[model samples]
Target: MRIHHHIGRRTRSGLLAGLLAATSALAMGIAVAQPGTAEAAASLRSLADAKGRDIGFALDPNRLSESPYKQIADAEFNLVVAENAMKWEVTEPNRNQFSFGQGDAVVNYAVGSNKKVYGHTLVWHNQMPGWTSNLSGSDLLAAMKNHIAGVAGHYKGKVFAWDVVNEAFADGGSGGRRDSILQQRIGNSWIEEAFRAARAADPDAKLCINDYSTDGINAKSTAIYNLVKDFKSRGVPIDCVGFQAHLIIGQVPGDMQANLQRFTDLGVDVRVTELDIRMSTPANSSKLATQAADYKKVMNICLAVARCQGVTVWGITDKYSWIPGTFPGEGAALIWDENYAPKPAYQAVAEALGSGTTPTTPAPTTPVPTTPVPTTPAPTTPAPTTPAPNGSCTVTYVPNSWGNGFTAEIRIRNDGPDPVNAWSFGFYFTAGQQVTNAWNATVSQSGTQVLARNASYNGAVAVGGTVSFGFQGTHTGSNPSPTSFTFNGKVCANG
Candidate 1:
């Protein structure tokens, strides 16, 4: 959501085949396959247009000033979602007081550009105003309903869709609800109520439940699947299920198509809401190639699903990717590099849509590749050494040095052909450096030695997958980069 800003020198960051045929036939009063991939289409939207689907991207109000961004957005996408502007904290920062300036700006652009607006999310656990956290029972319900009504009502006719409730389930796809203020105060009914309010405000807008880690039929996704089925059975007003296919560079879920198919079978439309494949920093040819394949794999999944409506990448470019800030040592998650030029992933997406060329700009001789720097680093300390008898891991330690404090970015790559259940990193500073702050990891320091243990979210690194994190530290005199790093007591080669 681009909610986190880090400090460095500066701060950081689908109609399916079979049923699509039947549905298109019934809906259009004729049975047929989507026009054989818009071969002549210039932009992604045009390609989707050929197939009678929408191609979209999440837009950031701040990035609109960049001509290339605006140009590409207008050209490639027919649909737009507010990256963060329409969320609770931004829309209703104060009780009953609403600020639609930022969100409206995006809507205004979309309207002017002849694009459809997909309101990002009326309710989310991550970005909410502090005031709502303490409310209970009726107060919470009132606030929730009021916020949804106000935001959804104002954009009543403007938005084509709204994520009425987002990311409500816990990780591990357990079906267990997350411990959120909304859940605590209003319980499970909050979701149905929010959807109802949204419907009352804007009956035509597609109200959806969106979440990550739900691209496949995992525990989390199964939970959402059941919820959608139950909603449909009770006429709960849900129109779509948004699977935020946020994936790693080489790990697109194998059952993605089947998963979306099951959701569509429940009589609700499914969409790929936020798609991006992140890789280890200092992206090499291999990683970027894998990313391109990953993108194509996801695009194909959506293309094959009849009820899959559209596809929206989380953000437009790698420059503003939320990954680096949150994951550390891992980035280059978008199709465009920091310079607004297309990468192989862009071409891959274009090809999948049957629009073989990048839409906005001509191909550059050498596109600037995304690199690991000090933009966003995860912080951490050492943990007890656990031995890995037969695994290989690589580490990349990059320090953005300054006067006394430097932000360190570390990439931990699982080089072996298997996943590491729990990995630990330890390094010793040659200089007198003391760790000050860290995130995305459990970090501790003892004299010149630092140990970083993986947090629950990032501990497991699949074979060839990388996890990154950064930390801020104060160093006396020179801040020498750690000469050696170890993953579970095994020396890690410099990435």
Candidate 2:
């Protein structure tokens, strides 16, 4: 769901002709592109890559058709997240029937460009097919499973991730689960069931629970933190936690990094899913500078955390940003201005990524302790296999179970005298297990064997440093831990 209130009604049909003309103009190099005459600078993607991170942008196909948006998106970003195409209403407008044309087009374009695609959401309160509102009990639960399976399965491996569940917590009232048709009819377990269904259908895409106002350790964020903790302690198939950084100028949360770190510490990946800083119309020099600082703070924090995967701006340019439509009198929320030129904020992000220091925010003089002071929590289960003899690395495999679906964490440690670079960990699951969602590492599977490579930030570990990643998987009958483990192709000595 959108953090800002979108005014009036939204209709894809209404903007078709205008977008078509914009596309034509862009092809002919006759459009009023905003980036004209702006000096070329290092792209955010390149800078992030240097730091072993990913830079991304959320897109509406209509906006992508415009030359300015397309040019910047293609050059500056390597990840594409569908802004509205994958929502429930758009994908399943008429009950049991499904139409994936819009979402498919977005994925197709991303694949053609060699970009990673993140599906916006599978379950959200704001957008739902009319047919769903009338259902109750089994009907509603059935509908939920059907929709998730259909949409997630249609894209299958094409989408790298999905916002499996979005905005499930209320801002007030003890931070309880938000009241929606799904929860109202199917009970609180709907969330866990949604993840389970998604894993069964795709078995590869990363599934995330996304929301706004979670940038800090506040009541809402606390509620989410507890939920994730419970999910991990048990065996819910949650992969990542998404924080929608829909912020105001000069108001970046001081504890944002700490909040993210706590989630990753729970053996899940964290991402800045939808980021935009909106300000009053006619932004002055000071406002722009403040926005730049806020942008840099976010970039630095993400780059600092090994489990912080990527950062995605809500939209590429202020010209098409949802701020103006949703929040009256508030505009200019993105990195690029209306004319497609890089704003001061863009430069700040680039500089932060280029710098090699850990990003830090000024601490509040008086802070509220949302949870315990975080310590390195040992893996829940002991190492399943023995340690490597000649190799100085060890692995601990832990799995939390529920029904036939489970979430697993893999912790890899360097116990040798030297550091390791570009590390890889491989294992075999004897129980016909298949991974559905993974984070903090690049994961792939070949039959019963699974391989996990380090992410851009976590590849290098010091002599005694430990780096870990996790995923959700499904199994039939008895689920047993892998019998053996390998570190960079060397079998461990101790079992």
Candidate 3:
């Protein structure tokens, strides 16, 4: 009935005004603003249903409370990712020994609340117990099999997917540390063995090869791509490629869509796993902007590709991110702020995930269904393209596929009783500069909006139906700026 409450408002006056307005509005029957239509519709950016994928966010059960978890549920997120709790040490501390207590808590919570669960890993180089170092040959394999069988078997159908192998390829090459017990004895063949074991444990779930450095056109990514391609070709039981987009302030991977497409073309799904945009230092207003911009571009990639199923932020809140501790000095890299409220990054991500940010003025009075953030096993079937209540409308996107720096298609949809006048669409550039693209939507500098404005062909798109402009901006920075634009209007929101 009211706009959901959260922390992190820049000024006290804004917070008070918001609270006052919410108190007044709560009396009405409005559910938190439904997804979105035309104006600020991030949903429009999403791939249509036939191409759906899972949208997941890693959660810390230890840090979660009933209320906050409920709040997350309200945000419309599709999947719930269990953080360290699903790892070896936390779940199975010693050999045949096991303890799903932590992971179980999360699993139960997800199941109880009707959220899908993604089992983080069956095998990884990190989070294993020290005793594993002593394991050799068949004993190690047995332990791995047992771990997979126990955990995967425990949840079975309830779990949507599993990260079967992690960081198996070294960036510098060298056979990926054959020193680890599984690799040392079983050799590279152990990876297949693990996946086979996972399938044996739970054939109903999706299997993935999760890794970093595979986010772009790097040697490591290509190599892994080949591996997945080969595995799929040979029926090796691999179904997805998880790209851990642990990005930097200005280094959004420009090859995002290409990378996902390459793998998907091989007949396997692709996902952005462990996504985080880290800064070189602690939190500041400027850095937060960088993070938001990073989040926006990342989600845009997921939306552009039909096979790029969905994404999962490694951790939802900056307070619990591994960035501060793992990278030292680099912190505040996720969508949720410290007190568990939507950060600019959260709103941006929500929008990118197809929940449009409603605009003011001509005002978005049309009530649209709040498509939950993500429920991707596959893109959902279309939600019955009903016409807008007041009149016929359409949304179209004339995407600029310079496909060089960023990957997106312009989403042009209108949902209003009357056409909007002197209107333009905008998103924050974060880098303090606008992207330069000769092939994008024609720019209209005549307006005051800073970034870009739509030329004649770009403005006043119809309602319900939409249009898109796609591109690959080649912007790179600590947390890069999007270097692609079609001048729909001056850019307003940013990371």
- What tens-digit string does per-residue lDDT give for candidate 3 at 1-495? 011111110000000012233333233321222121224333222222213455667766755553433444323344677766777777788777788887888788675544568888779866677788777778788888888898899878778889888777776554243255566777878888899999999898999988776788777888887787778778889888888887887789888788788888898888888787777764666676677788889888987878787777765555555665556576667655454444557556656655555311111221111212211122223222322223233323332222222323455444444454334444334332223221113322211122333322224545343433322232333223333222233221211
Judging by lDDT, tell me the better candidate of 1 and 3: 1
Ranking by lDDT: 1, 2, 3
Q: What tens digits encode model 1's per-residue C-alpha lDDT throughout 207-249? A: 9999888887788899998888899999999999998877888
Write down the TM-score of every candidate: 0.66, 0.65, 0.62
Q: Which stretches in model 2 have alpha-carbon errors above 4 Å?
A: 1-39, 355-495
Residue 333 error for model 1, in Å?
A: 0.6
RMSD of each: 23.1, 15.7, 15.4
lDDT of each: 0.72, 0.71, 0.57
Alpha-carbon runs more than 4 Å astray in model 3: 1-51, 173-179, 358-495
Model 3's lDDT to the true fold? Answer: 0.57
- Count the clashes in each prediction: 23, 9, 66
